[model samples]
Target: MKQEVNELIDPSKFRDRIDIKGIEKSLLVDMLRKMVLIRKAEEKLSEHVESGKIKCPCHLGIGQEAIGVAVSLVMRKSDRAFGAHRSHSHFLALNENTYSLFAEVLGKYDGCSHGMGGSMHIVDNDNGFKGSVPIVGATIPIATGAGLAAKMDKAGDISISYFGDGACEEGVLHESLNMASIMNLPVLYVCENNLFASHLHIDLRQPSNSTSRFAKAHHINYNTVDGNDVVGMYKLLKSEVESMRSSNTPYYLEAFTYRWKGHVGHRDDIDVGVKRGAQLDSWKKRDPIKRLADSLIYEGVLTESEYQYLNHEIQNKINSDWEKAELASFPENEFLITQVYS
Candidate 1:
C-alpha cells in the first residue's frame, strides 16, 4: 500500500486539469498573469545570478507559481502569510511589487526588508505577508501565534504558513499542528510537497509521501490537490478559507508540486548525483501557466494574441525591474547596526 501510494503521488505522473466551465474568465486571466509574472521574475533573477550580479542565495520556484497564486487569491490584504526558502512567488503573488522584490534580492536599502534580509527573509506587513524565514520550520510556530492573535481579536483574519515537504520533518511542525487543532485556531498549512528536500528525494526521507496524514494524526481537516492546477487550488483554498472563517478552525492543504530548478541555484543541478533530470523534464509538460492559457483559449475566454501580449508585457516589466535593481544602491554600512543587538 505504501508503494501504491508512492506510485500515485509520483510528480512525473501529474497532469494539468482545468475545467473552464467552472471558473470565471477574469479570474483565469489574473491567475495566468500572476503565474507568468512569477516565472519571468525568477528567470530574470536566474540571469542576474549567472552573471555574478546577485551575490545572495536564491531558491527559485520556477514551476511552482500556481500554488502561491491560488492561495493569495483566497487571502485578504489583512490576513497574514508566511513562507520558507523558496518563497519569491509567495511574496510577489501577494505584494505584486517586482521592483521591491528585485531590490530586496539585490540587497538594496529600498528592499522589502531594507537590504538586511535577502531572498529568504522577506517581509511586507502592509500586504499581510508577515515574512519568510530561511530556517526550515521556523515560521510554523510564528504563523500559529499569528492565528492565535487573530482568534483573540475575534477577527475573521487567518494566517497561512507555506512550507516545503522537507520542513515537515521538523518537530515544531507537528507541535504547531497539534496546538492549532486543539486550539481551533484559524491557521492554514500549505505544504508544497515537491518530492525533494534540497538534494534527497521524499522517498529517502519519509515512510510515506503524503504529508496530510500528519493532519489526520492531529485530527485537522485536510485536502490534497495537484499544485499545478491553479484553478483547482484556488477553488479548494477558497472553500477552506471560508470554512476556517466561519468556524475559526485550522486547515491543512498538501499541494503536490515540482520545482523546475535545483534546490538553491539557477542551474538544474542535474549533475548533483540526482537522476531527476528526466523527471523534471516530464514535469514541465505539466506546466501550470500554459495549461491555464490553453484552457481559456480553448473555451473562447482568452485569445492567443492576448496571451502572447500578456507574456510580452510581463517580460518587459520584469526586465525593466531587474535593470532598476541592478542599478540600485546597497544599504549604507552604518545602518546595519540599527537592527542588531549585542
Candidate 2:
C-alpha cells in the first residue's frame, strides 16, 4: 500500500498529463491565475518569515496550490470554508486581497481577523472563507456543524474543511465524519495529504498511506486525487461538489501532495528528515502553475510570452499589496482585549 501511495505521488506518473480537452478556457485560465498568485504570495510570506519580519509561524503550501484552486472554484459564496495551519492558498484562492492577508500576518489594524490572528488565523465571511486556524483539528467539527446549519436553512450551501494528513490522527476528525455521514450533511472534507505531519513522515504514523480509509469507515463517499493536477481536480470536484450540494451528503477528497518547504517555515528542512532533496525536485516538475501554463501554451490557449507577461503582472501586484500592507499601522494595545471573548 505504501509503495502504491509512492507510485501515486510519483511526479513521473503525471508528467505528460497536460491536456486541457473539453475544459473551458476561462476556468483553466482562472485556475492557472489563482495557482500562480497563491505560489507567489506564499513566496512573499516565506521571505518575510526568514527575514524576522513575520513573527508568526508560516506554513507554506507551495506545492499544494492546485487543491485549493480546484476546490475553491467549485465553491459558492453562500458556502462556508475552513482551513488548517497551512491555508494561505485556501484563503487567497477565495479572496485575492493579498493586502489584507499581509496585514493579518503583520498584525496590523486592517487585517482580515482585525490583526489578532496572525498567519494562521484568517477570515472573510463575505467571501465564504469562514476562518483558518493553526490548531490541527479545531475546524473539523465546526465545519461539520456549519454543514448542519446549511441543511437546516435549506439553502443548498456546503461547508468545506481543509486539513492536513496529521489532523487525521485527531479523534474530533473521525467524530465529525461519523456525524456528518449519519446526518447526511452537506460537507466536503478536504484532506491535503502532504506526506508529512510536521517533521514525521506519514508512513511512520499511519497503517495506510491514504486518509480516505477513515471516510470509508464512516461510510462517507470519498476519493484520493493527485493534488498537483489542477485540471483533473477541477473535473473531479465539479461532479462531487455538485452531488454533495444537491444530495445533502458528505464527501471527502484527500489530495496527495508534497509541501515544497518545511512544515512551519520557509526553509526546506531537508537536513534531518530522510533526504527529500531529490523528491522535492521531482515534485517541482509537477508544479501546478507550470503544468497548467505549459498545457495552455501547448494547446495554443496562451503563448509563452503571454504566460510570462501574466506572471509578471501578478508578481507586481503581490509586491504592491505587500508593500502597502506592511506600512499600515498595528492595532492599539487595547484592541486585543476588546475582541477577546469571555
Candidate 3:
C-alpha cells in the first residue's frame, strides 16, 4: 500500500493529466488566473533577488500556488488562515494584494505589515489572514486557539493552518492535532508535503512519505490530494471545510507538492550542496498552472487566446504593482521607536 501511494504521488506519472469534469468554467478560469499571477509574481521576486534589489530572504512557493488558490475558493473573510515561511501564495490567494506583499518585502511603509514584517511575517487581519510566521509549527497552536474562539462564538467559521512536511516533525503539531480532535475544534490543517524539509528528503526523515498518518493517529478526518491539482484540491477542501464549519470538526488535508526554487531564494537550492536538477525538471513538467490551463482548454471551457490574454493581463498588473512598491518610501526611523514593544 505504501508503494502504491508512493507511485500515485510520483510527479512523472501525473504529468500528462489534464482531467476536468463537472467543474464550472468560471472557477477554472479564475483559478488559472490566480495561479498564473502567483507564478509570475514569484518569478519577478526571483529577478529582484538575483539583482540584489531585495535584501530580505524570500522562500518562494513558485510551484505550490494551486494549493492556495484552490483552498481559498472555500474560505470566507470571516475564517482565519495562518501560514509558514513559504506563504506568499497563501496571502495573495486571500487578499489578492500583490502590491502590498511587494512593498512589505521591500520594507516600504505601504506594506501589509506597515514595513515591519517581511515576507515570512505577513498579516492581513481584514482579509482573515491572521498571520504567517517563519518558525516551523509555530502557527499550529495559534490556529487551534483561533478554532477555539470560533467554537466559543458558535460562528460557522473555521481556522486554516498551512505548514510544510518539516513541520510534521514538530511536537507542537501533534499536540495541536490531538487538542483540535479532542475539542472538536473547527480547524483545517493543510500540510504541503513537498517531500523535502529544507535540504533533506522525506525518506531520510519520516518512515512514510504521507503525513496523514499523524492525522489518523489523532482521529481527525483527513484526505491527501495532489497539491498540484487545483480543481481536485478545491473539491476536497470545499467539502471538508463545509462539513467542519457545520459540525465543528477538524479536518486534515495533506497535499503532495514540490517547491521549484531553493528552500530560501531565487535560485534552486542546488548551490547549497543539493542536487535535484532532474527531479526539479520532472516537477516543472507537472506545473500546476499549465495543468489547469490545459484542462480548461481540453474541456472547451477556455481558448488558447483567452488564456494568453489572461496571462498578459495578470503580468501587467504584477509589473505595475512591483513598480509602485519599488517607488514607495521606507518607513521613518522615528516610527520604529513607536512600534517597538517593551
Candidate 4:
C-alpha cells in the first residue's frame, strides 16, 4: 500500500549553448534544408489529414525535427535506428523516400510499409531505419537486440532508439537500459522530452523532470542537451556515437523540446485545453528552426536571401512529392493477404 513519488528534473540546468564553429557552410545549409523539408512535409500531411486524405492517425513531430536530422548526420548506413509514433522526422532525417512516406500515409501500394502500416509503422531498412511503432517502449528491446546482433556480428554498427519522455515510464525501457549497460550493447537511447505525453505535462506525471536519472541507475553514460540546438546536439552525438561504436557502450541523450501542434493532429490548441495557451506561446519563442536560421545568418554562414531560397526549394519538393503520392495507386485487394506471414 506504499505509493512512490517521482521527482521532476530541471532540464535547463544541463543546457549547453555550443558554439557553431568548425562546421562547414555546406553542411549547415543542408541541415537547414532538412529541417525545412520536415516542417513542410508535416504541414502537408496535416492538410491531407484534415481533408480526409490520410486515414491513419499521425503523431506529427513539427517542432522536434532537428534532433533526428542531427543524429542522422552522424549515423552510418549499417547502424540501426528506431522511432515511436511521432517519427516522420526520424524516417525523413535518414533520407527516406518522401513519396513512399506519402503513399504509406495515403494507404497506397507504394508506402514504405506497402500500405500495410500507416504513419506510426514506417520502416526503411536500406537507410538503417529498423521500424517505428505505436506502442511506447516497444522498440527499446528491439533496439537492444539490434545492438546485440551488431556486436555478435562485429559489424561496428550501433542501434539508436528515439522515444518520448512518456516512454520512460514503461518498465521495458528500464529493463532495456539495464541490459544494454550491463552487456555493453552499442545502443543510444535518445529521449525526445517534449514535456508532454498527450495532454499531461511531465511535472504532472513524473517525479523527476530529468529522465537521465534512469540512465544513471543503469550506469549508462548520458548527456542532456538543448533539443532545439541542432549544432550542439550534432556535436554531442558525434562524440557519444563514436564512443559507443568504439567501446560498445550504451549512451543516453535527453533532448528538451516542445511540439508546435497538438498530440495527434494539425490543431495546435484544440486538444491542448485551457492550461496550455501561455506555455505553448512561450515555447514558440524558443522555436528551433527560427533560432538556428537566425544564428546562421548572424554568423555569416548563410544570407537572408539564401535562406529564403532554401525554404522555397524545400517547399517545392514537399509539394511535388505530395502531388506524386496523391496520384499513386492503392494496394490491390488481392495483395491484402500477402506480406503478412512472410
**Superior by TM-score: candidate 2 or candidate 4:** 2
RMSD of each: 1.7, 1.6, 1.6, 3.3
Better candidate by TM-score, 3 or 4: 3
Model 4 over residues 1-342: C-alpha lDDT tens digits?
222222212323323333579898888878888888888899999998889888899888898888999999999999999999999999998884788898899888899988889898999999989999999899999999999998887878999999999999999999999999889899999999888888888878788777888998899998777788898899888888887888999999998888888889777864464456656666666667887788788899889999999888888888898898889888888787766677
lDDT of 2 by residue, 1-342 (tens): 332366666766776646688998988888888998999999999999999899898889998999989988999999999998888999999989899999999999889987889889999999999999888899999999999999998988999999998999999999999999999999999999988898887778888888998998899999888888888888898899888878999999988988899888889988646646657888778777888888899898888988889899999999999999889999999886887775
Candidate 4 TM-score over all chains jointly: 0.93
TM-score of 2: 0.97
TM-score of every model versus the real structure:
0.96, 0.97, 0.96, 0.93
Clashes of 2: 0
Worst 10 residues of 4 by lDDT: 1-10
Please report, as a residue range, the 10-residue window in candidate 2 with the lowest summed lDDT.
1-10
lDDT of 3 by residue, 281-338 (tens): 8888888888888878877798999888998998999999999999999999998898
Q: What is the lDDT of candidate 1?
A: 0.88
> lDDT tens string, model 1, 34-152?
99999999999998889888889999999899999999999998899989899999999986799999999889988899888989899899988999999999999999999998888
